[model samples]
Target: MLPAIVLSVTIARPWREVYEAFWRPEAFPRWASGLSDMALRPDGDSWVGEGPDGAIRVFFTGHNDLGVMDHRVIPDGGAPVHVPLRIIANGEGAEVQLTLFRQPDMDDEMFARDRRWVRKDLATLKALAERG
Candidate 1:
């Protein structure tokens, strides 16, 4: 297990609203640039999307009331990368946090790139959630 990189943002929305916006896999592409064209798999338990390398599959693990949005991203033929996401109450709004784990085999350059991507995605999510 490698150290986790955490990125967070405060959104001007209720915790539940923020969680709901991110709960749906289809909304991922709208905020996460690394993913696109997401669709439910035949099994209906996972989602398939076009990733930077190729097809990517994602499996989410959490409950609606828990505000936990942990998910596993499996790139084409690659091992799963676990991503932990959470939304918490912060004053009149909410704070969203995303944790990106560093893979043992990942180099500093790749890890930095992933960190930048996560930051951008979180910003996008905040903007989207606050737009309402």
Candidate 2:
């Protein structure tokens, strides 16, 4: 079985503002801890970046921040996973659903390492948006 964390983050800001920041790959380096650098190219509209292995950039579509990503890790003979984000408009602000799906198969030591990374990342994202 895969262990994953799905969390909801509410930002006390306009939904559009929050969504745009999320869609821009460049904004990731600021909020995403594991990502080194990220950008979107004009040609294929493809996004590129370097992060913890098993992650890929996909142009996000739909009524979201507007980006796509295939950040999934599939075990032997398994299928790819998916992560989804949805922004909801609150009274004068917004909340976000960070849909996470992963097969938690890493060893205990590595699991702890990944958890730390993830925790810091969510915190950073919250701070970045709220502070802006």
Highest-scoring model, lDDT: 1
Give TM per candidate: 0.90, 0.64
Candidate 1: pairs in clash:
none
Ten contiguous residues minimizing lDDT sum, candidate 1: 34-43
Per-residue C-alpha lDDT of model 2 across residues 5-76, encoded as one tens digit per residue: 666667798877877777555666687656544543323554545545634454444344432322432322
lDDT of 1 at 44: 74
Candidate 1: global Cα-lDDT?
A: 0.83
Instruction: Summarize candidate 1's per-residue lDDT along 41-114 as a digit string, tens digits.
Output: 52378888778888988887756797888888888899988888898999989999988889988899999998
In candidate 1, stretches whose alpha carbon ends up further than 4 angstroms from where it belongs are 37-43
lDDT of 2 at 127: 84
lDDT on C-alpha atoms for all candidate structures: 0.83, 0.59
